[model samples]
Every structure is written in C-alpha cells, then in structure tokens.
Target chain A: MSITIYVPADAAALALGADAVAAAITREAARRGMDIRLVRNGSRGMFWLEPLVEVATARGRMAYGPVAAGDVCGLFDADFAGGGVHPLLLGFTEDLSWLRQQRRLACRRIGVIDPRSLADYKAHGGGEGLRRSRSLAPAEIVSAVTASGLRGRGGAAFPTGIKWKTVLDTAASQKYIVCNADEGDSGTFSDRLLMEGDPFQLLEGMAIAGLAVGATQGYIYVRSEYPHAIEALNRAIEGARDWLGNGPGKFTIEVRKGAGSYVCGEETAMLESIEGRRGIVRAKPPLPAISGLFGQPTVINNVITFASVPDIFAQGADIYSGMGCNRSRGTLPFQLAGNIRFGGLVEVPFGLKLRDLLYDFGGGSRSGRPLRAVQVGGPLGAYLPESQFNTVLDYEAFAAIGAGLGHGGIVAFDDTVDMAKQARYAMKFCAIESCGKCTPCRIGSTRGVEVIDRIGAGQAGQIALLRELCDTMTHGSLCAMGSMTPYPVLSALNHFPEDFA
Target chain B: MENLPAIERTIEAIVAAKQSLPGALLPILHEIQDGLGYIPSESVPRIAKALNLSRAEVHGVITYYQHFRQIPPGRHVLRVCCAEACQAVGGEALAEHARLRLQGSDLTLEPVYCLGLCACGPALQIDETTLHARVTPQKFDALVDALEVDP
Candidate 1:
C-alpha cells in the first residue's frame, strides 16, 4: 500500500530545503522498498514549523514538523513510513489549533489541494460555481456578482459586480480582463497564497470575468517578488489544458511578471508593467472600464476579486450579500500580521468589529506589549487609533474611521512604534515608488519627505507645509500613489501629534 | 511611442492573451521579457502593436505599475520589500542596512513592494528563490553569500 506523505507547497518550505526533504523521503522509501505517496499540498499556515510534513494512515493525517533533509534519518527511525509517532508529531492535523479555529473561505482550498490540478480542484468543490456560471447568461452572472456585494480588494473598494456591469455595458468588442496579482501590500499574502496555492480558483474567476464581460482574453500581472507564486501559477496554467476548451471562445489567460516595483500594485500601473514599460499610475475618466488594456475596455480586478468570482456564483448573491453591512457584503480574507500573536490568514465575514480580528482572531500583539496602532489596509491605508478599533471591518466602516480596508491586511504595532516616523515613511514610500507621471506625486512626495524630515528635525512651519502638500497630493495626483499617499501621513499626524511636534 | 497611452496599449497586449490561462503569468512574462530583452523604456507602442492596444491604454499600463522594469537592471538585483508588514518586522532597519551595504556599488537595491512571504517575517528574493525568515544582518549576508560577486 502506498503511504501518504504531505509536504508543504509553500515557497518557504522549498527554501528551507523542503525539496531536499521530499527527495530524501522518496529516495529513502525507494531504497528501503517502501510505498510512499508524496503529496505536495499548500502550506498549513503554521509557518514557524515549515517543511512540516504529514503522514496518513488508518488514523487521520498526522504532522511531522519543521522537517529538513538533515532530519530525514531520524524520521525513518521514528517509523514515519509506517506512521510511527515522532517527536514532531502533532497527532491529527485536524486537531491543530491553527487549522481548526480558522474560518477559512478564500483559503479554504489553499494548502489542501494541488493548485493546478483540475481533478484535485474539482474533487475539492472547485469551479462548481463556474460550471453553474457557464449555464447562466452573462447578465445573469453580472447580477449574481453584484448581489454578492463584492468589491475590489485591491485597495480601491469599488464594487466588483458594478465594475463588471460597467465594463459589460461599455460597448467595446475588444474588452479585456486583467487580474492584479501584484499584491504589494505589506502584511498581506492572500493574493500570493491564492496564486501559489489555489491558482485555478483565480483562473476560474478570470474565466468567469471573461464570460461576464464578453471578453476573450485575460491577463494576470503578478510581481517578480512572488517567484513561488509565479512558478506555481505557471504550473497551474500548464496543467489546465484538460479543462480549457476542447472547444472555442472558452476563454484564455496569460501571466505577466513585475520586475519588483510596488507601485505596480496599482491597477493602471500593473497594466503598464504588463506592456513592457515602467509602472506608473494613469489618469482615470476612462476608468479602466471605458479604456483599459490595449485600449480595449478592461475589467481589472484584484486577486481576491477574481478569486471571489466562483464564490459569488456558488453561493447566490443574496446569500453573499447577506453577510456584510449594507453594501460591504460577504467575507474578507485578512492577513493578521506584524506584531500579532495569532498571525495568519483569516476569512471573516464583514460587519465584525476590528477588535474581533485584532484581539480575538489575532490573539493580540506578537510582542506581548500593549496594542498601539493598527494599520488597516496596505501601506497607503491610514492607521486607525485604538479608539476606533471598535469600528467594523467593512469598506464604509474603514472609511468612517479614516482608513480604507486596503487588501484586508491588518498590521499590528506594539507600543514601541513611532507613529510620526511611520507617517513620514508612508509619504517617503510614495516618494520612492510613485511613477512620477503627475506633478503632485512626483514633486509632492519628495517635498513630503523633506517636510516630514524638517518636522523630525524640529523645523518650524513644516507641519503646515506638510498638510498643504498632502492636500495637493490628494487632489492633484493622477492616481492613488499620490492621492492616498497622504492617508498614513495625515492619520499619524492627527492621532499621534506628539510624534510630529 | 511618444504618446504615453499609445505605449500603454503596446504593453497591454504582451500578456493580454494569456491573462486567463491557469498559471500562465510567469510564462507570458518569460516570453515578453525574452522578446523585448529588458522591458523597453519606449516599447509600449511595440507592445500595443503586438497586443492590439491603444496608446493611452498602453501608457496607463506602463505608468500605473511596478515590476515592469522599463530600465536596465544592474548585473545583480537586490530586492527589498518595504511594505508595512516588512517594516513592522524591522525591515526598514534591514533595508537601511542593505542600502548602506549597496551604496557606491554596482549592486542595484530596489524596494520591492512584497514577495508574498509574510509568514516568514522578513523575506527577500534573490533571482528566484524566495529567501525567508531573514533574522540578522549576517543571515541576509550569508543568504546572498554565494550570490555575492561582481555587483
């Protein structure tokens, strides 16, 4: 009988010599004339114990953690081939607290299935929505998405269905669908994990987008920093031949790799990067819907946006919409990172207070210090003070607290952080990453750094100039880089004035 | 080529066809990068031509972006993620350390947005391998020890 061996498909595992461990296990098993079925599943999310392997027998899936090639010998002695208990054995995989408590929706299939294997995906209830979607009219699909109350997860909280509907009605035969996999936000890996661990879901979502918008082509503009995600996505595409039409107009996809610029995370910038140029934000009015990729009407959705496509159709829009507050329906996949005790990915329904995520789901600060500021959203998102932690995790809720639910990444900061410096850093970050296409972004960002520096150096008139400059950036800049760049700066300035003065 | 948006169209077509392909991103990038050598500073038009995109459309793609390198990179690429998550884990300090190390040298240190290895705390990408859990300055050095050459 073939014994089951589970090695994480996570890039870290590969880096920490997971490939070597898997190889050793196979080689050793072969040398000893044993039967071992190796399954490269996505990470179980317990990163501290990476290269964590699992063995399956008549009992449930058991864990052998932090395994390396160097530890292969000990594994054999522990009789792992025969499912022997070892020091690292954490008993049943289901009982692991990390996996049990998580209310996984976006990551439900992640770490549990081979990303590209349609059979593996289908077996695990993948594309059941797409199969259902294929039966519906394009308008029906659009309505379904709208009903789900889904919005863009790429920082801009645009409604996903509305955007699709806009694109669908935009009267362009050459419409395009672009997947923004350039997840540049800090403390966020949902996009990367989804791309790496469950690529087909994204692909399936892209296909649904194509069908909905009457588009024939799609593009996934991913960052080069995601080598594993890129590699895994490549494998996922290659492995999709079976599902791709034995027919025509069935839909097609291509992946574009970013050289490593965070600004590419911006939708327009991602478009530019895909076209073999430097990434810069574009002026909207032609709202990617009217004029997007290749001058064709484009529907550029974030990784989470595309990933949520299947869910919209799988679970009716009413059901999807019923979850969140007013317009912010359904669940959001948030990454609890940076100074958090219970850090990992959590897909929680909307309307839940930020405190639930920060304290309950996140298990408080990783530093064991009093929680200070929580930066909701990515870098551009504003830092919510402790007073506003009671706010819900919806788009409107985030906005009410002077923050954007950007990419659903909540970065925790202990009492040790310098909010003033952090604020300055946000502007400084925009200064460094801004495409320089617009004057406010190009000039304002540099000026912002200078002003913040002047303030840091105890210069007079710096704060006033900083506010004026932030206003100019917010209004004059063509894109979010300069516009939203001031969110952090302003929030920090308002909440922690002590840091500035 | 002069009109930024026209150039954007050229860039859009490079990966438009394969965008929906399951796992098609890196391959499309390899193809595009291979065809254009380094991502062209002025080839958005060429990209638009290849992919049937508009100039303004191309410009949007080019400018509102990162990761699509329009300029030639140094012989050695040193990427650092300065996102909030990384910064929280003292990535800012690590970045400063790296910047000091790369100053006045051929080593091109670029601030990448994210490499997606958040769980590893501080992560870096040298070439392709996603280097994870970089704790100390020495660890970062040794991770790139074999890669430390001309640049």
Candidate 2:
C-alpha cells in the first residue's frame, strides 16, 4: 500500500505556504524512490497550525504542522512516512486539545478527506442525511429540521425551519433555494471553510432543502473574492451530478459569483445581485420566502445552516436539539481571530461563556498584551469590554447586552487597540459597502465617519450627534448594513469612552 | 489600451461561453476581465448587444462593482486587507507599508475588505491568487523586492 500524506489545499493553509510544502514533500519523496499518495485536503480549522500535514498510519493520522517547504527534507530523514518519530510530530491529529474539545458536527470532515473526492465523502459518514431525507416525506423533513432547532448561521439568527415552513406553505410552481456564500464578514471564515473543505456536505444540505421545499433548482451565491472556493464547489458539483438524479425532479445546483460588495451578504441584496443588477436591499413587504430570486418563493440560507442539514438527517434531530441552549439549539462554529494566539474555528454547542472562549481557547492576545476590547459578530457587532466577557454565547444573552453573536465571529483586540478608530472603521466600511438603497445608511455612514472625526478632535457636542445619527441609521435604514452599523459605533463609545479622548 | 479587434475577439469569446446562462451579465464581465485583465470601454457595446442589455445598464454594473476595472491594472496588483479584524493586529500599518513600497514602482495597491485569513493576518493578496499572512513592514518590502526581481 502506498503511504498517504495529507497536506491541506485550503485557501488559508495555502496562503501560509502549504503548496510549497506539498511540492517539496513530493519532490523529496520521488527522489528517495518512495511511492507516496499525497492528497490535498481542507484545513481542519486549526488555522494556527496551518500547512497542517497528516500522514495516515496504523495507529491513526499523525499530525505535523506550521510546516514549511524547508522542513520537508528533515521530515524525510526522520522516516515520517511510517509515522516515525519527528520533532514536529503532534501525535495523533484527533488527540490535539483544540480538536478534542470542538464538537465538530458541520466541520467534521474538513482537513480529514480529499475535498474533491465523492467516494471519500461517502466513506466518512456523508450521504446518510440525503438517504434519510429520501425515505421521509417533505413535511417530515421540514419538521425534522424544525425539531433540530437549527437557526440561520448567516449572522441573521432567524429560525431556519420557520423560513422553510413559509416556503412550503406558499404555493409557487417554481421555487428556489439560494445558499448565501457571500461571506463578507471580516473575522468569519466558517462559510469559506465549509465550502473549501467539505463542499459535498453543503451540496447535500442544499439538495435536502430543495427536496423539503419542492424546489428543482438551487444557486449558491458565492463571493468573487473566494476563487478557490468557487473552483472547489464547481468541481464537487460536477462530480456529484450523478448522485443528484432526475426522477420525479432533480435538484440541480449552480454556482453564482457575487461582484465585490459586502452588503450583498444580505438576503434581499444577494437576491438582487444574483438577478444581474446592482446589489440593493429590497424592502420587507414580501419576505424572501414569499417573493425572492426572479420573484418566486425562495428558500435562502447561509452556508453553515445548509451544511448542518446533513447531520440533522443522518443523525436524529433529537441528538442535535438535545445539545444547545434555549432557542439557539445545535452546535455553532465560533471563529476566534485577530490578535488571539489560538485563532481558529471552534464548533461547540451554545452556552459557552465568551470569557472561556477568549481566555481558554484563544489563549489571550498573540502580542502578549493585556486584552482590552473584543468585537463579536463582525463589523456590525458590538465592541465588548472585559465586564461583558462573562456573558454566555447565546443569541438572547448577547442581545440582552446590546451585542449580537452574528455569524459567531469573535475578533479580539489588545490594550493597543483604539476603540474610537474601530468605530470610525465601522462607519467607513458601511459607507463604502452600503448599497445606497436607503438614505440613513448611505448618508448617515459618511456623516458618522465625520462625526467620529469631530469627537476625536474634541468637538463639544459631537458625541450626542453621533448617538442621534446611530439611532437614525439603526431604525431607518433598509437593511442590517445601515441598521447594524451603529452596533459597533455606539458599542465602542459606550464601552470604551476614553478612546474618543 | 489594447486594439479594438483584440478586445472585440475577447468579448465575443466570453459572450459565446456564458451568454446562455440565467443572469449572464456578471459572469460575462468576470470572464472578460479574466481574459483581458480589464473590461475595455469599447467592448461595453458588444457585451450589451450580445446579452440583450442596454449599454447604460452594462456601464452602470461595471461602475458599481469594485472588482470591475475600467482601465488595465499594473504589472502586479497587491490588495491589503484593512478590515476591522486585520486592523486589530497590524493591518493598518501593513497597508501603509504596502502603499509606501509601491509608491514609485509600476505596481498597483488596492484595499480589500477581507481575505478570510483573519486568524493569521495582517494578510494581503498579490494579483488575486498568492495570499500572504502575518506580513510586517520588512516582509512586505521583501515580497515586493522578490516580485520586482522576478518580473
């Protein structure tokens, strides 16, 4: 049997020289008359240990990481193919503390299997959900998802079942399922991680959604920034075409790319972008579940929400629902990033304390500075102080503190961080990425940036002005892009007031 | 700017490949950019005609999207992430470094929202493919030097 060596081809992993490392390993292996099977898998979400190499051994997969091209020659000398003792050996990949602790329901197959291989996907407990969905009725599938207590992981936190139920109730001859892969949130990579890692799981989820909602076609609206993910998804879609049979009806999946706009992540905006127009937010008279994508009833969901579907069907709905807290059930992939030491993906059940995630998993700041402020849920999320760190990572819990667990992305900052600057950045980002559909968002954001500048310049009444502006933008804007921009700005001013001085 | 005939050929080929898809405008634009490095202004009429869209609509879309460049880009395009997550580390400083390094060079530097490498940032991408993380001022200079040497 040829020795199998796994090197991640994940975008983040590749960014860190994984490609070079793989090439170097291959060159050295060939020179030494070694017959090795090298597979390019997805990142395990253990980003800090990227270029995380796993060699299949009898004991299990032995891991080595943060590896470079230069390290390959030394690895060969250590006879690493047989899992021989090497200085960089991390023992078994599963035994790592980070991997051991994470309840990886959606992220289980990531970094473990070749992302392009359909056989590999099925071999590792993949198609059970689709098979189960096939046996059950459409209503039963919807109810099963509802019972699983899965909510949209696309930062909206809307109940996934409720959305599907609405679509199911609506009478439309032509319905559609749109997977929002326009993951523009700065700190979040869960969607990209899943698409690049276990794209089949996402495809399976979409297929299940199509079956449940009685939709024949599905479109995944991915961002143009992720060329690798787009490529990976296209490859998987081509390979899985046979599995997606055309009997009563076939669930055909198409990949659509978003032209660089952050606001396009919004459901209505995404729908508009997919229609080959400017990405403008549509008003909520007819929710997307009623009139979406070519004015048909559409089941629009985030990548993680779709990815979670397979496990819900494969395993029992009760098993998933039994895990999370009140309302926010099932596991959520929490991304720890920016200035943190162990910044990566931590998929766990709800109810973990924000402090525990910050200190325990993140290992404090990478710069070894005293942690000051942390922003949860991307640019639109609030900037929290240490006092709020004890808050549980629940939707309602975060809402109670005037914060959101939007997309479950937590970006940390050290004492060196300037909250006022961060607030300005929030406004600036809104101004740049705003769809210009509403006045409050388009004008308010530019004015908000100017107001912050005034406050920074010690203007007497600009603080109150900023507050009032945030109120207008929050309540009056068309969508969350304008409405939620105030969350970061106001949270910064309220929590870390001294930054303005 | 490139000649009209070559630009016409590029647009025709892209339209032939993608004109049949639903909402074919964006994909067609992307393919044209990919093939010709930028969407030539003269080819807008051809694209609009091929896709049954008005020239104004095509122009509006081209202007709306940041990814669609009217003029051709320089030899190398370096996109530095200036998003909040990256700024928490040293992204601000890194962007400034990139700006300073490419000041007199024939390289173009643009600001990107995020590259999904927040965990290992301050991150940057060179020419839409090669991504570099944990980039400091010195490292930015070294990467630029390497690019210049190779080019």
Question: In order, what is each prediction's RMSD in angstroms?
Answer: 5.6, 1.1
For candidate 2 chain B, which ten residues in a row score worst on lDDT?
B1-10
lDDT of each: 0.77, 0.91
The model with the greatest DockQ is: 2
- TM-score: which candidate is best? 2
List clashing residue pairs in candidate 2: none
Cα lDDT of model 2 by residue, A133-154, tens digit: 9877889989999988889999
- What are the iRMS values of all candidates? 4.8, 0.8
Task: Judge candidate 2 at residue B82 and give its lDDT.
Answer: 93
Model 1 interface RMSD, one decimal: 4.8
Q: Which stretches of candidate 1 lie over 4 Å from their true place?
A: A81-83, A276-278, B1-76, B99-110, B146-151
Model 2 misplaced regions, further than 4 Å: none
